[model samples]
Target: MSGHLDYEINKELGECYLFMGELDKAEQYYTKAASSNGVHADPYLGLAAIAIHRGELEGALNMYQKAHKVDPTDKTHAGIALVLMEQGRGADAFGHFVEALKVNPENMVALFSLVRLGHELNRLDEVVPHLSRYLEIDPGKSEVRYSLAGCLVCLERKDEARAELNRVLEGNPDFEPAKELLAQL
Candidate 1:
């Protein structure tokens, strides 16, 4: 088989392990893939995700930066922003998240991170609008709906928030956060 095929297979296996919560196996395969190809970005991205899961934010940032340098994709930028946020650099993180969104406005990760950062900064107006845009992109995502409800509540839009919360509950009958908010309402 070709080296590129081996690299692709290894990268896929790495992603599978990462999604299955097996970071060690994921990292091993990603490293193998990256060393094999050194041309594709997926291996670097998989390694960065493993680093993030392992709480090695600096390593994750380095890997993600390399992925961005290799591919210049929105996913790479979003990954960097997420790790930066995990490292407690909220302001810097938000900037990269915005850049990722500007690169791909429908990036769910960037949108979700924006909502989180906006809320943390007490910028309810910004949060709600971002959530609204997220909804436009993926109206069926229950988590985004829940977040939108939270943003609405923060903005004192009680009725709209209640409606959104109800929508969340329609998908997940036992959604504790929505249940709690409904009780307060």
Candidate 2:
């Protein structure tokens, strides 16, 4: 069989096994795919996920880094950031998350992780523009707007926070948190 065909078959098998939670089988196929000279990062990404599931933080980080080096896609950046976060390196993860967001502003995982990290790092002010950008594309997301409101409140920008809460309440009148937050404002 051609190398490309072998890689595709192996990578597909790896994905299928990974989806079925057969980590050992998945790793075998992923390894085969990675060594087939296909120059693809899916195999390494699959390996990274397996390592993460097995509580192998260092291995996961290494695999994610390899995948990023192969192809620095938003997913690869997110993967690297997740491994860094798991290793208790929030400071290092922040930049990777930012890079992921830069590549795809609508990447929910990176956006939410960055928001959480911002709050943890006491950098709520820096998270506003990203939230705003997301909201611009999706206005009816009450949870996201609520999160933005919370950030604004922490930044002492009460007026803007109140406006955001009001918008959330407008979208879903039964949203108790928004109502409660607006009342507090």
Candidate 3:
């Protein structure tokens, strides 16, 4: 088989092992994949996941950086942002999450994390636009809409919050959180 083909096979095996929670086997296949193609990013991303599973935050960050250097995909940016969040670097993570969203606006993980970090760090203004964008994409996601409502409440936009909460309640009448929030308004 060609080197690229070998890399693909090994990378697939690595992903399977990772999904099965066999970190050692996953690392071995990922290493083989990396050896097959020194420039491929997928193997490095797999390795980064293994490092994270092992609680080696620094190693995971390094591996994520290597993957980003090879190919700056939304997944790589999200991975880097997750590591940064684990390290309590919320501001840095926020930027990376934003970049990830820019690459793929429908990235749910980045969207949720950005909203969460924004709340934790009191950067609610930065979060509103993203939340609005997410709501535009997935209007039926009542939980997310409820979160947006909470953010609007924090910003003292009571009317907007009420509208969002109403939307959430309309979608899922049994959503107690939205109902409670609406009651507050």
Candidate 4:
């Protein structure tokens, strides 16, 4: 059998196990794939996901960083930031999230992290701009609209907040959070 075929089979097995919630078996197959000289970062990414699911934030970060080194894509940066955030290193998480956004502005995970962290840090002003960016990229995402509305309300922009909340209700009239926010306004 070709080395390429072995690598592919191992990586796919790893992903399958990971998605099935078998982290240890998933890691074993991922390690096999990574050791098989595969060209892609799929095995490493799978290992990182397993580490994350098992609450090994530092291990996840290291695996994600290694995957990034292998692939150097925007997703790798976002994955690293997610692990950092899980470890409660918000400032460091923010930086990696920014890097992911710089590489791919449409990276939703990175954008969402920035908005959530900004709100947590009492930087409500930052939330609007990031939310605006997300809305521009995915205008039909009602969740982003709701978040934007919440941030606007926090910043004392009642009219704008109300408008966005109305937009959210237009999509999902039964959305309790949107209804609750609207009632507040």
Q: Model 3, range 65-177, lDDT digits (tens) per residue?
A: 99999999999999999999999999999999999988987788998999899889999999898888877888899888988999999999999999998888888999999
Best TM-score among the predictions, by candidate number: 2
Cα misplacement distance, residue 52 of candidate 4 (Å): 2.1
lDDT tens digits, residue span 74-130, model 4: 789899888878878887888788778878877878878888888777877855776
Instruction: Tell me how far candidate 2 lies from the true structure as C-alpha RMSD in angstroms.
Output: 1.1
RMSD of each: 3.6, 1.1, 1.2, 2.2
List runs of model 3 lying over 4 Å from the truth: none
Ranking by TM-score: 2, 3, 4, 1
How many clashing residue pairs appear in each of the predictions shown? 0, 0, 0, 0
Residue-level lDDT tens digits of model 1 in 118-183: 888776686576677767877877888988888888889999999999988888898898899889
**Candidate 2 global TM-score:** 0.96
Residue range 1-185, candidate 2, lDDT tens digits: 89999999999999999999999999999999999965899999999999998999999999999999999988999999988888789989998988998898888999899999998888777788988998899999998999999999989999999999989888898999989888888
- After superposition, candidate 2 runs with Cα above 4 Å error: none
Candidate closer to the true structure by TM-score (higher is better), 3 or 4 = 3
**Pairs of residues clashing in candidate 2:** none
Candidate 3 shows a clash count of 0
* TM-scores, each model vs. reference: 0.73, 0.96, 0.95, 0.85
The candidate 1 region of ten consecutive residues with least summed lDDT is 123-132
